[model samples]
Target chain A: MRKFAALLYKDLLLLVRDKAGLLFLFAMPMVLVLVMTGIQDGAVENSSKKTVSVLILDKDRDEMGREIISELQRQDLFDVTLADSTQTASEVQQAVKEGSFLIGVYIPENISSMVRNEIESSLSEMLGLGSTPQTDTLSSLKVFIDPTVNNTFRTTMMCYLREASNHIEKKALLSTISETAQEFSPFPTDSMAPPPDLKPISIDEIAYSKDAFRTNINVTEHNVPAWTLFAIFFIVISLSGGIIKERQDGSFSRLMAMTCPYSTYLMSKIVVYECVCVLQFLLVMMMGKLLFPLVGLPVFSMHGAFALCLMIVFFCALAAIGIGLTLGTFASTHQQASVLGAVTVVVLSAVGGIWVPTFLMPPFLKAVSVLSPLNWGIEAFYNVILRDGGIRSVLPNCLLLLALTVACTAVSIVAKKKI
Target chain B: MATTILRIEKLRKTYPNGNKEVLTGLDLTIGQGEIYGFLGPNGAGKTTTVNILAGLLKQDSGNIEIFGKPVASDRKNTMRRVGFVPQSIAIYPELTAYENLSVFGSVYGISRPELTNRIGKLLDLFGLEKFRDKKAASFSGGMKRSLNLMVGILHNPDLLILDEPTVGIDVQSKVVILEYLKTLNSHGTTILYTSHDMEEAEHLCTRVGIIDGGKLVAADSPEALARRFPECHDLKSVYLELTGKELRTMED
Candidate 1:
């Protein structure tokens, strides 16, 4: 026991003296959290109020073409632009290709003539006057609508065109049919197929109201806090180098010569590393509370949040130390130990939802996350911060983390024996 | 003999590569209150013999008895009576001199109060009291050597094993270390020392063993070995006459 205390004291002294290393271990994570939050928050805000540009090619000089262009301008959904005659199809295609225009519409010529022909044909058919007239004028008129427009925009424009065509056709038919009826000396104008009467149709458009889709969730509130927990866990792996150093320096052999059991030495290391990790976790949390609010996250009751954080920190530290011990036992040099430790932490953290949200990952990847202790840590953080969970809510994650810690420690002990 | 503190019989160590034998049927016994000097040129297996005795390396076949108990049978029990100061500086540089001594003392199961007292005495004995608070990193080569020896003796084991304890220190520091070891031996502590300096070995060792090619060529008092050799007038002459003037270098 006295020997164990000595070991602990020695480790603490080494840590204290390494001021630069300590600062990096404790401060770097908080700095990363702050920087990451700022960037992500800005990006999310910018994406919510997205803008789409559109190019319009008006070929028809008629009133119908002008009305269509005006209708597009009245709607706020698109930033509309009129392309001049010199701006050929190639230029419009290039703009669309370059992503400058969300879409492009080309109005064809003779659209007015097609509308007049449709009115004459409909009135003549209704009055049974002259044989049914067929000429292909309507087909030419259909070409005036841009075929490249998206379905939503195209439908709106078609609706407007149809309304205008109905009004023009009705007025032309009413005047021509009534004048013919009077010249033919009819008993009443109604006798000539009701004088090809025109009826008015009501057109109503209900514009959709745009809602503010962007919310004010702070960067730290989303995932940075969880990543901070993961970073602390990674630092625990660096402590494995201490064990390798002891072994290389012959201190381990010297201690063994002093009648101390190998088990005692390993346990002492685990205890010291766990303590360091817990301290780091607490420091990061305090920094978060002081700094997170400055970045715009809502400040809530820190008591429950800190409690959940501590529980996760404890389990993560235990597991990380166990991993460190396992690596230390097998490594022959400090470099090898550091490499293995870093690789293990990175792979685990990546799978554990530290880098990518588990929700965004595929099912298999999410299933693989169960193998990572970091997953439980981040999940615990999410429960506290996002779900506003208390101890009862985070209990399962806490239990799993604890179980993992025990399992890793056991595995480390076994590996140490083999070494 | 005054109670044999360390006894080894038919110690054998063979490397796995080419089945090369490093220690071939060697045997020796060390008595209490005696300074036993193990001498050999480089690659003469002096370090291997010391390592085997210190329990740092396991021997292929050997029977080691420390304080009349078999070290091979129960190493932990036997190791409690022994303290090892390796040829290299094994103390932590990041820790202060006092802290290093305290840690090493505690490893032998010394209590907190006893460790504090032991550490203070060791620092004072090595003349490191003034620099006790400073880290070992700041210490000069000789200071580190002194602290290293101090840490090894902090627990006051029955047998202190030192491998080249004064290899790299200044003359003054070497004298201090040798005098300290002699003082400890006079107080009934057994010592096993390894060195290549013939003059120091002749002056300090009560029984000197000359080993060459992993074989014990001669074992006796330095005067006896000199007297036995016809042309030898000093320990160096005896060593040169027996082992020959050859530069021994290890291949692997």
Candidate 2:
């Protein structure tokens, strides 16, 4: 016990003395959290809660075109605006192309008349009357979308516009049919009010997890855990460099020659570095919860699962330390350890959904992401913070992280024997 | 003979992925209270022999007994009686001189009071008292070497192994280190030293063992080896006559 304490004390002293290293360890993650959340929050709002700007170039000066614009505004997804009268079709295209508005609708002149004529001709043919000749001019609604918009949002806006136009056409056709029936029938059409057109099926969205609390995945919630895990895993560079230095300087050999087993030195490193990892996590989390709101970002919350969230962080630290030990044991020099450790951490972060969310990745990448320890860490964090899940929910991810720690530590020990 | 402090019979080693054996059937013994100079050229299996005794390595085939207990069976307890000063400066540069000694002393299981006393005594003995609170990184090369030697002897092990402990230092520092080894020997500590400097070994070692090709070629006092090779005037001449003048390079 005394020997272990001595070893631990020595390592902690070294860490404390390296003021630059300590500052970088804590500050870099905080900066990443703030910068990443600030950048991603705008994107999150644009895709979900924030309204998309839509421009209307209504040339028809008719009821149909007006009704479509009104319908678009009524929906919560779009903020409709009237385009300048002097703006030509080319001007409208340039505006949309420049991303002044996410979408632009061009309602051609006489669109209402064209629809009515088509309806009359169809009705005349159906009633066995002689059909009127079709008009030579063709008028249709044209939509202009900004090229920069993501495909998913573009598809959604297109679907909504199509549905709005179709609904208006159906209403006009129904009114025409009703008027024709009133003219031919003996009974008055207004004797009794018609029932409202209520659809037979409606959809209600429910929370997918056990908790009924449906939360938005704001940037704060997403970035805090991701950057924290990144900072934690990046400890490999420092830890591995320390190991290589010890080996090169002969401190490792001197300790090995002593009666104190080399395992004590390794255990001391694990204990100290793991604590540093946890401290890094807490610092970044505090930055998100306290400092983010000051910068106009959402406050990061764990959904009241603080204890469970910390458990995941602890497991994440172990996994990180395991990798550091393995890297330090195998790498022959400080440069090799540092370069390889940094590259490995970056690759892991890339595949683990730290830089990009897994849901947005392709299926193959998402499948590969599950193999990364960072992915397991972020998933566990999401379960507790985003999904409002319980211990049972995060158990699988935590267990996987624990397994990684065991495998890496085992490999490090075997490698240390060879060293 | 005095009690055998360390004994090795038929020790052999070949590193993994290595084409040649580093040590082949090497045999040696050192008695208590003897300053034995184990001499060899570069890659003559000198450091390899010391590393095996220090338990930093395992022999492929050998019988090693330290203090009458098999080293293979009881490495932990056996190593408690050994101290190794590597050729390189091994002390942590970031740590203060006092802190370095305190740490190694504590790990050697010395009590806090005893450790403080020993650290103070060592700092004074090595003329490092003024730099005790300073970081080792700021020390000159000679001071760093002294601190390295001080760390090895912090626990005052029964068998002290020095591998070129004074190499690359000024003559004054070298003399101080060589003189300290004599003082340590007079206090009944068995010493196994390896170095390329022949004059220092001749003046310091009670007995000298000249090894080549993983085998000891001559074992006697320096005076006797010089007399046996009548044409050689000193230990260096005797060493050259026995080992040869051609430059040799081997890696362990």
Candidate 3:
């Protein structure tokens, strides 16, 4: 026990002296979070230019069909394409299914005449003179929609299409009434009522959210936790380098030459690196809490965030230290340890959503990202920062990170034996 | 039974890279409190033997007994009573000399109070007391080497092995180290010494073993080996007579 304490103390002393290492471990991540948030927020500012692809299959090919298609094109929200005449409706549906088009609009045959006939009958009935109202009126349009489209985008497209149909119907009715009122009215000419003022459909919006980040979230809410985890795991580099340095300097073998247990020496290194990682995590998170909101980014706090964060920091450090020790034990030189360690961490970070959020990744990549502890960690952070969730929300992620830590430590122990 | 401290019989080791044997059925014995010189050229497996004894590497075949206990592959308990001052500078440069000694002492199971006293006494004995608090990184080569040796002997092991301890130091520093080692021997610490300096070995060693190509060619006192070759009066000439002057630039 005393030897372990001595070993741990000495390791801590050496690590504290490495100023550059500490900076890279803590400050680098904080800076990265800020920089990435700034860039992503700039992107959010120009989000109105986003586009969704729509394919139109106009079998009606009439004045009403052309007008409705023109109105949709005018919205500037869609990259509109008219379907090829060579393809059947089923083929076009297949295209939509394959994600080639976000939505497909198929207008039925004679839809313009059908709409006109319905309008004329309605006018005649109101005048109490002429044919009965048509029972089969064309009011529905066939829309082949991509099921995987964003909910917001799908809602906007559906509303636009509905408004176009309503406009066509209203224009068709008003014309029919103007023509018939002069010729068919039995009431006195002066008593003929002016067309009732058409009231445009209006929407009233109400919001009932009490959560802070429920209304909207910016890049800061995502990046602060993301890059912080990324930065903490990068300790693999310095930790491995330190071990390789010890081996190169012969202190490693000298330590082995003593009567001390290998378990104590190995455990001391693991403990020290874990402590350093936890300390860096706290420092980065504290910076996020103090500095992030000042920059006008969305920020929210959940109760028990501190304890949950500490648990994450510990498991994350353990996992990173495991890799560090494994690489250290196998690497024969400083260059070997540094190069291999850096490559490994960079790859993990890439898949783990440091470069891009796993939610936005392609289906396959997103599925693979689930195996990345960094992705798990980012999700836990998002639960708290965006959903107002607490420790209970992040428990599963913490457990998985712990499992990875154990696995990595096991590999490290095995490798340490060969040395 | 001359109170043997170490016994190696038919020990053999092959390098991990294969195709070569480093130690080939070598045998040696050292009695209590005697300075036994291990003389060999480079790549002659002296360090390999010491490593095996210190539990850093395993022998392919053979047995080693220290104080009647078989030296287990790990040398865990047996190592507590043995010390190895390696050829390289093993002290942590970032640490102060005192800090290095304290840590090493604790590893050998010395209590903190006793370790403190041992550090003070050993530092003063080696003339390192004044520089004890300074970082070892700033020390001269001689000071580093001296501190390296200080760490090994601080535990007061029954058996102390010095692997070319005086390799690259000033004559003054070398004299202090040699004299200190003699004093340790007088106090009943069995010494296993390796050096290229023939004169120093001639003066210090009670018995000598000449090893070449992982095999022992001769074993006796300097005078006795010299008497075998009347033309060789000095230990270096006697060593040359036994091991030859062929340059061993490659592993055997």
The best candidate by DockQ is 2
- In candidate 2, position A383 carries an lDDT of 84
True contacts kept of 3: 0.56
Candidate order by DockQ, highest to lowest?
Answer: 2, 1, 3
Interface Cα root-mean-square deviation for all models: 1.4, 0.9, 1.2
TM-scores for every predicted model? 0.77, 0.92, 0.80
Provide the clash count, candidate 1: 1
Chain A TM-score, prediction 2: 0.85
- Could you tell me the lDDT of residue A402 within candidate 2? 86
Model 2 Cα lDDT, one tens digit per residue, A332-418: 988898899899999999999999988889999999999999999999988887676789988998889888888988888787777
Kindly provide the TM-score of model 2 when superposed on the true structure, using C-alpha atoms: 0.92
TM-score of 3: 0.80
lDDT of 1 by residue, A1-419 (tens): 77778777777787778887678777777666666666766676554444446677666667556766787677666578888966655577677767667666555666656666667677677777875568465533231223455565556556655765555556556666666567677477556554444555567553221213323334555555566666767664567777788888877777766767777787777777677777776665666667667767533234357767777777777767766776777778878876777788888888988777787789999899977888887777767655657788778877887777677667766765444
Worst 10 residues of 1 chain B by lDDT: B14-23
Assess each prediction's global lDDT (C-alpha) against the native. Answer: 0.75, 0.86, 0.81
lDDT of 2 at A236: 89
Ranking by TM-score: 2, 3, 1
